[model samples]
Target chain A: MEQARPQVDLEAALAASERRFRLLADQAPVIIWRAGPDKQCDWFNKPWLDFTGRTLEQELGYGWAEGIHPDDHARCLEIYTTAFAARERFTMDYRLRRHDGVYRWIRDNGAPYYDDDGSFLGYFGSGIDVTDHVETELSLRRALSQADQYDQQQKQAQWRQEMLIHELNHRVKNTLATIQSIAMQSFRAGVDVRSGLAKFEGRLVTLSRAHDVLTQSNWLAAPLDEIVQSGIEPFRTPEDDAFTIEGPPVCLPPKMALSLAMGIHELCTNALRFGALSARGGTVRIDWQVTGDGEGEQLELTWREAGGPPVHSPGQRGFGTRLIESGLAREFGGKVTLDFAPGGLVCRVHAPLPAEEPPLVGGLVVPHH
Target chain B: MGRRVLVVEDESLVALLLEDMLLELGFTVVDVASRLETGMSAAEQAAFDVAVLDVNLGGETRSFPIADLLRRRGIPFVFATGHDPSSLERTYPDAPVVRKPFLRGDLRNALARALAG
Candidate 1:
């Protein structure tokens, strides 16, 4: 009788404890949930309405899955089913649309409960909002990848600049070597030193000017008139008299422009030093004509120096003379002839210009005209 | 005399200097092809005891494309370059290289080493 009385008292105390726990759960902001062994929500605390903003009927059974984002609902359900079938705790975080239609992440945690016979009875669960934490993690990963890609691109640009520096150094050395040989031979032959130096400086400046024009297009090509003007512009003076340039605006390939510019430079320097362009009223007229089609096309150029002094042939064949005749001729694939008439100095150069590269998109891409 | 030779150099002075050295060595001079696309093809078409080739033509290194073709045809050709030897070593490791601004004897020795090796 004493043992049985103690047992009843213990049972009453346990019931009181259970009531207190349920009451506390009803007061909390987070929802306490219970489901049957069939995986259906059978009990929900008072806070369930506040969390889901649903009537009792809508908050019961599998109705809670309605608030989940459509994209995540199927995947969440699949995982939930797998966990439930394996009789394990199911915990997942996913977006659920609120009553205000704003999607927010939720952390849903639940553990399977069993009967005395070890058979599944139902489940005990709780849910909390975790949207801020999830968004922070994803945004952090994206920032890391962006920074990594930026570093890689910076490294590539640095390598490209180093290579360019090396190429520029090599090109400058070769230019100096050619110029040195010319100066040495001129000094050895006892040409007028001052005039020779002036000739050298003038030639270099012409070459430099042509290079500057091509550099604007990244060493690609410069227009025919651009090459001619740069070669003769320095001698053009203000006093209402300057060089005349008239040519078809054709872009010359790098090799042809380089050689032709140097050749033109030699002729202009000679004129500035002694020929038709030396005196006060000197002027040069330039023009070019292109004929044929495709790879067969050829360009004929005429440079006439007038209005200064009469033309006369140089006494000896100098480097400038050779360069004008041979260098331009070889590069141009045509002939160059000088007409040293008593009236003026005239030069005609002919060469086959390279074909232009095709456009990226096919067809005769006529611009909006 | 066992054989004759041909020299193909673009620089006129260098060509004259090479011709004088070849004559002193008792080898008959044949021909000189200065420009590319013509130089190596001239070699393949003609027969010479040994040929001296300049690797750069008008600032082009496509000289190797023709040289490689000549080597494949079983001609013993040597390279005489104003450029660096280490730069040419990658493509022409087995081919003999003589740097420019060389002495008269340097050409004869290089020609002999090329023929012998």
Candidate 2:
């Protein structure tokens, strides 16, 4: 009877201790689990059950592994089994399904449990949701990559801007050289100084007008009609209908347009001095057409004068003649002819057109009646 | 009566100015070329003591080919350009550069230095 009483008391003490452990585990904020020496989970705290929305029966003996993410399944099993076999501590993070059916990251910590006699029992582990931390880290990485791309784009833009500035410097220097050359031409020996300065001033105005047209197009290409009109604008008077310009829509590159503008200026100077524009009841007809196709395309432009006093060729070639004939021919791979017929003077330009560029829209033809 | 020099410039006015400068410096102008092909031919065939090479001959064209031809002929030349001179140092380290819009003195000095050695 004494043995039976002590046995019952011991049984009661063990039951009470088990009841206290359950109560403490259920109320703790963390999810707690217990596994046996056989590596099969035996118990889960209330929090663990609530997190998985599964009963303790379903979670026993590896049933809890069903809630683990498929991607993390093998790794989690390996870590847990290795730690359990070695009777060592382990820390791991893995995705687990919650009661709401959302997968969340969980950080789990486990250590081998021991009895008072220093014998290994099983394992006691705790876990908490770490989804927020993982999401923050992932988003930070994405933002860093985007910032790197933006930095690279900014560097490319800066490099392009530097190239443009260098081009601008080269162009400006070339313009200054042109002005210097014009000055030397105007003030050369045997020329009257005042008339030379006047001519220089006139040339400056013509160059400035060309620059204005070029600036409007961002220095890319200019309409041929616009260049001609701007070139002849200074020579126009309210009284006389002495000019006719007719041409199809054509777009000239910057270099061609500048040279053409200067050429028109020179031609106008000659016409005002001795050609059609020099006499009343006289007219100058400027016409052009695109001929041929593909690579063989040519632009044939002509200037014909009519009803002027009988004309004769000049005794010696001047700067204008040299520029129009030799300069244009060499620079643009073209031919220019100046014929002084007794009726009037005629100038013809035959040049190959550049390939694969669309003509300008909205022709600006000025027809004189 | 003086050093015969060839001038290679695309712009006619600029070429004229160079000719005048060469004349003032007592250099006889043998030939003036205004395009890459012409400049190359001049560099190859023209009989001259030295050459004045415009670095850019308009558009994507450059006078490097003419410079190479002159180099192969054992002819000394000076570069005239509006670009940064240091950019040319990689290819033509010893050749002197005379900047555009230069006065008679600048061209004279560059020509002198180029022909000295």
My TM-score estimates for the predictions, one after another, are 0.68, 0.79
lDDT of 2 by residue, A267-310 (tens): 88888888888888788888899899766778788888888888
Docking class of 2: acceptable
True C-alpha contacts between chains kept, each model in order: 0.00, 0.54
lDDT of 1 by residue, A1-369 (tens): 977998999999999998998899898777778889888888888776666677768868898889889999998889778988888898988787776788888888989998789988888888788888888988998998999999998996686565455445445444554454445434544678886687667766776887788777665667877787776677666775547777677888655665577667767777877776778766777788898887688889888888767677877765555565544564345788888877788888887776763221111121121
Candidate 1 versus the native: TM-score? 0.68
How many residue pairs collide in each prediction? 0, 0
* Candidate 2: stretches off by over 4 Å: A1-45, A55-97, A101-103, A107-126, A356-369, B1-4, B10-12, B23-47, B57-62, B87-91
Q: In candidate 1, how many Å is residue B115 off?
A: 7.7
Candidate 2 clashes between residue pairs 3 or more apart in a chain or in different chains: none
Worst 10 residues of 2 chain B by lDDT: B53-62
Candidate 2 accuracy as lDDT: 0.83
